[model samples]
Target chain A: EAGVTQSPRYAVLQEGQAVSFWCDPISGHDTLYWYQQPRDQGPQLLVYFRDEAVIDNSQLPSDRFSAVRPKGTNSTLKIQSAKQGDTATYLCASRGQGSNERLFFGHGTKLSVL
Target chain B: GDQVKQSPSALSLQEGTNSALRCNFSIATTTVQWFLQNPRGSLMNLFYLVPGTKENGRLKSTFNSKESYSTLHIRDAQLEDSGTYFCAAERASSFSKLVFGQGTSLSVVP
Candidate 1:
């Protein structure tokens, strides 16, 4: 079985540019999450979805970051007018519908904003 | 304040040795999960626990919700064990999100 998959393993963008990261979650998984990891830090939750509805996004920067899981399977996280501080790895993970289920993570997209 | 605090931000261990990593949570959590991010930047699940201990090969993890802490032990460490270890907790208030610790970078040398 394939794990969670993400596209554009790496991205380099100038400040004020825009970029979109895509994620394809595991099969039959009901929960998908997007996390941001700066260098030397652990993954921080940005947003999450159960099916097609967002669970929580309070930690996300509403002014620039937006995420959507339209079909409940694939997800997209877009950053509008990225800044140098946005340089970090975007990780995607998915888990089954259970309190004890472990998360399956994807090969994150490393973004660098100049 | 850090909701999840990891101990010994970095560590160096010789092959075949053993070491333990710890995470203390400030938030009330019910479950905990441990992951290892390899050099290639892929997060691999190591253990998931609900106030109990689980062992897999040379890796063991224990979660103590009452104490608001968790631990990951790597025994007989190998070169392939070199990576960053993270401990995440599922808060009692949150629906199903994990609050991760800063992480413990482990390097196993020959």
Candidate 2:
């Protein structure tokens, strides 16, 4: 089966610029998650969705970061005003509905804010 | 304080050798998942556990819910096994949400 797909494998932006990352989850997967992984660190959850509804986004930076999964299949995460601290890899993952399902991740978009 | 902490932040091993990585959780976790982030930055699921042990080829993992720790063992390490290993835990109160460790970077040299 094809795994999760993400566009723009890399992104470079200046401070205060805007950028968006897209993710296409695996078919039939019910859960989608967006994570931020800084260099030398593990992935940190930014937001997640079950279908079209957001399940959790408490860790998301409400001021500049926003995410949406309109059709419940594809998702987009946007950064209104990027900061240097935003320099990290943006990873997208999906999981099935099984009780003990494993997560599948995309190649990830490496973002650099200078 | 970190909710999940991984030991041996970085390790270098010779091919054909064996090494083990560990993760300790501060929260009450019910399930654990291990992943390897390759050089190209792809998170590959290696094992998912619930208080027991699972083995795949030369890799083995065990999770102890009572002690709130998990371990990943790599045997006969290969160059292809070089990557960053991460262990994430699902809290008892949070079903799908996972808290990740800082990760252990492993490099296998031939």
Candidate 3:
């Protein structure tokens, strides 16, 4: 019954640098999500996947942000050429297929782009 | 415009007091979920609702899909209750996509 796990608790990089955040979702969960939370704000959806296929990513900054859940188990979100506005917490969450299943979140990776 | 709006952007409550947070959805939503983001930056699931009421310990939540709104009530608040509370909604036209409110910052002090 392990919860969603995200790696690299924190990351600091200069503008234009690249960084990647990883997430290992709970076992048996089929849906995974990535969210961005700015300081003092609620999380905003960046992307999500149902198994290995992306469900939606319209809110993502396609030019710089890319996400992959290749095997449908673990996921990675990458930011290319990070900007100061990218300084926020990246959160990973997972949910089961059941209609009533609740979403579980990870501790999140706090990113600071200077 | 915010699809999900939370009232009283910030609040302060003395320990043992009671308070409530609310979210009003401008979109057609089928379900609602509430979460507590602690100071350390961990998001904890508080309640998930589908047009009904539920209670856990000193907390209670009610979601009225017909009115497109949800509420979270905290009773006998403790210091541990200090954090930001967020409410998310699942649109009736879209499944598995959750839109979150700006959040209500709650500070419970002794």
Point to the candidate with the largest DockQ: 1
Model 1 earns a TM-score of 0.97
User: Candidate 2 chain B: worst 10 consecutive residues by lDDT?
Assistant: B90-99
For model 2, the TM-score of its B chain against the native B chain is: 0.98
Docking class of 3: high
Mark the regions of model 1 whose C-alpha exceeds 4 Å error after superposition: none
Could you tell me which 10 consecutive residues in candidate 3 chain B have the lowest summed lDDT? B90-99
Give Cα distance to truth, residue B87, candidate 3, Å.
0.6
Error of 3 at A4 (Å): 0.6
* DockQ measured for candidate 1: 0.91
Model 2, residue pairs in steric clash: none
| Winner on DockQ (1 vs 3) | 1
The better-scoring model by DockQ among 1 and 2 is 1
| Per-prediction TM-score | 0.97, 0.97, 0.98
Stretches of model 3 off by over 4 angstroms after superposition: none
* Candidate 2 runs further than 4 Å off: none
Could you give candidate 2's per-residue lDDT for residues A5-92 as a string of tens digits? 9989999999999999999999999899999999988899999999999999999999999999999999999999999999999999
Clash pairs for candidate 3: none
DockQ per candidate, 2 decimals: 0.91, 0.86, 0.86
Query: What interface RMSD do all candidates show, one decimal each?
Result: 0.7, 0.7, 0.6
